[model samples]
Target: MRILSLILALSFFLSACETVKGVGRDVESAGEAMDDAIND
Candidate 1:
C-alpha cells in the first residue's frame, strides 16, 4: 500500500512537470512571435 501511494504521487508530480514545461514553451513561442512582429 505504501509503495502504491508513492508511485501515484510520483506520477502526479511528473505529469505536473510536463504540463508546466508545455506552458513554458507556449509562452516562449508567443514572446518570440511578438518580437518578430515588432522587428518587422
Candidate 2:
C-alpha cells in the first residue's frame, strides 16, 4: 500500500512537470512571433 501511494504521487508530479513544460514552450513561441511582427 505504501509503495502504491508513492507511485501515485510520483506520477502526479511528473504529469504536472509535463504541463509546465508545455506552457513554457507555448510562451516562448508567442514571444518569438511577437518579435517577428514588431521587426517586420
Q: Model 2: how far is 37 from its true place, Å?
A: 0.5
What lDDT tens digits, residue by residue, belong to model 2 across residues 1-40?
Answer: 9999999999999999999999999999999999999999
Q: Provide the global lDDT of candidate 2 against the true structure.
A: 1.00
Q: Which regions of candidate 1 fall more than 4 Å away from where they truly are?
A: none
- For residue 3, give model 1's deviation from the true position in Å: 0.5
Total clashing residue pairs per candidate?
0, 0
Clashing pairs in 2: none
Cα lDDT computed for each candidate against the true fold? 1.00, 1.00
Worst 10 residues of 1 by lDDT: 1-10
What TM-scores do the predictions have?
0.95, 0.93
